[model samples]
Target chain A: MPKQERAEETRRRILEAAQETFASQGYQATSVAEICQRAGVTKGAFFYHFPTKHALFLALLEDWLSQLDQYLNPDRYLGNNVAQSLYAMADLLKAGLTQGRDYLPMFLEFWLQAARDPVVWQATIEPYRRYRAFFANLYLQGMNEGSLCTADPSLAAVAMVSLALGLLLQGLMDHESVNWEEAAPAAFRWVLSLMAPDPATTP
Target chain B: MPKQERAEETRRRILEAAQETFASQGYQATSVAEICQRAGVTKGAFFYHFPTKHALFLALLEDWLSQLDQYLNPDRYLGNNVAQSLYAMADLLKAGLTQGRDYLPMFLEFWLQAARDPVVWQATIEPYRRYRAFFANLYLQGMNEGSLCTADPSLAAVAMVSLALGLLLQGLMDHESVNWEEAAPAAFRWVLSLMAPDPATTP
Candidate 1:
């Protein structure tokens, strides 16, 4: 492999190892040495790729957030009927948010890091706010298109995201409480019905 | 304080101090010495009350779960109407789940501990299952009483609890997203309406 290509590959391997270690052992317990060992790379390689362990973790966070954003394509499949779009969005979330072995701790670790560290927290909050607005805009688009019931879209978005997070957490912390995939469809239906424009008011 | 009262007060103090330290510094970072320092008790006194830091954490977890049970008393103020009972429960949860300085870390720490340790995980899981049944029973009562719309109470209860948990997590992570107290009442209304029995079907 070319020198540049080989370097990039090494960096990717280190990141994957770090993500896994951090997810399994948690942010506090996982270390650069361990991540380097797992990646089959030396400490020098780890330092060459990332300045600090926190920087590498930030890289992991960005990648995960990007993956999450890709799944929530409101513009692509949501369409003008906001209520239907909302239901569709929930279905998409249910499919996307399966609690894989490595995902939950990594995700929760982000929250824990954000809680304690100002720099990390500031970086974390922007994407979170963007996520909230993304949902809000979907609701607003539905209302403007005359497909949704006239209620507070922002507030509804808040409720929607809150409910999704809660479900994800239950799946994470306690796996057997509910079949998230089955329940997601039912939940989406309920929320959509709440947002749908009244037949009496519709032309 | 009397001799017995003084000892009880010291135990409470140690538990509270441990909880605060663990929540803020995390489980791995915190030490029994720090807890003793915070509690204004000696190491001997700390050891006298609890054998180990892990044991104290377990005790704290027990208290947290029991406190939740007390908080979710459906029969506290509201009577036999299942809808009233549920709303009351939801309202209590909203009012009680404060993150402030001490709670958020402690909450996340428990989760992290549960993830890493099987013993801790098993200890925490039992009460969590009880929450599911507690909610399911409320819905079953509501349905049988004819005050609620007829539906499968078990699934509905699971959904409702999921929503509540999701909201609680959001509140813990992002306090500014929604005025939870106001939103909580609306959530209760939404669930009750969705599950309420049709008047025509009532016996």
Candidate 2:
């Protein structure tokens, strides 16, 4: 491989190592040395890619958010109708979360960091707001399409994000507390249906 | 003061100081020495009341959960009727979260700890499940009172909690992210209304 491609490969290995260690032990507990050892790369290589552990975490956050944006790209999911589309989004969230269960600890780590570190919070919130706005836009489109209820788009958007977060927390924190595979989407569908356009008005 | 009363008072002071420190600096960053100094109690006294910092945290969690239980005592808040009662709960949640905003960081800490520590997670999820069951019972009552619409009570209960968690997180992580003061309750009301009994069947 070319130099740039090899460099990129090294960066990816470092990130994967960091994520696996962080997920197993936690962000605070996982040392940079551990990440280097796991990645089979030198500390120099790791520092060259990420000046600090936090910078590496930020990179992970960016990568996760980009994947999320792609996964939730509205174009990729539109059901037979607007209401179904909303339900589809909920299922997509469940599928995504369930698939990412191995990294659940890392996700919680992000929340803890965001709550404590202003820099991490900034990185976390910017993406959160973008997703909120993205959902708000989708709800607005549903309203304009005249197939969704006329609830405040911003309010609905906030609810959608909030519900997703709540489900993720429950699923991660309380394994076997509930059959979330059933309960979460059920909760999502119930909330979505409340905001679903009146069936009487659907064209 | 009586011996027991003095002990209780010391405990309260330690908890208060711990909350203050944890909120401002976070759980991991806040040291036991700081908690002792802030509480104005000797380390001996601190150790007597709580064996470890983690124990102190669990005490705080227990105290917070008890307060929540008292605050959400259904009898304390029954609107003119059942449907209104559900909405009242939403408003109550908003009021509670807003009042507790000063300690939002600590709340997030609990979640992170729960995700990492099976013991903490066990403590957190037990109360969570109790609250979920409590809300589920209320929804089921609404249905039985012949006022609520026909819907699965469990799903509504799950949505209610999940939405609140999501809203609290947003309000905490992204200060001034949105007018959550308005958006949260509105979102809550929207979700509650969906589970409200059909007006046509009201006795």
lDDT of each: 0.72, 0.80
Q: TM-score: which candidate is best?
A: 2
lDDT of 1 by residue, A1-203 (tens): 99999999999999899988987777877788999999999999889989999999899888888877887766766544666556566566566556344587777788788889977777666665677688788768777887776367766666666667666666667766667677765664565567783333358
Question: Where does candidate 1 stray beyond 4 Å?
Answer: A75-80, A97-99, A197-203, B1-3, B97-101, B196-203
- Name the fnat for model 2: 0.75
Ten-residue region with minimum lDDT total, candidate 2 chain A: A193-202
lDDT digits (tens) for residues A1-203 of candidate 2: 99999999999999999989877666777789999999999999999999999999999988887877788876666776676677766677567657767767677778777777888888888987988998888778878887677548888888889988888777766758788888887778777776674333358
| Candidate 2 CAPRI level | medium
Query: Which regions in candidate 2 have their CA more than 4 angstroms from the true location?
Result: A197-203, B24-31, B197-203
If chain B of candidate 1 is superposed on the true chain B, what is its TM-score?
A: 0.87
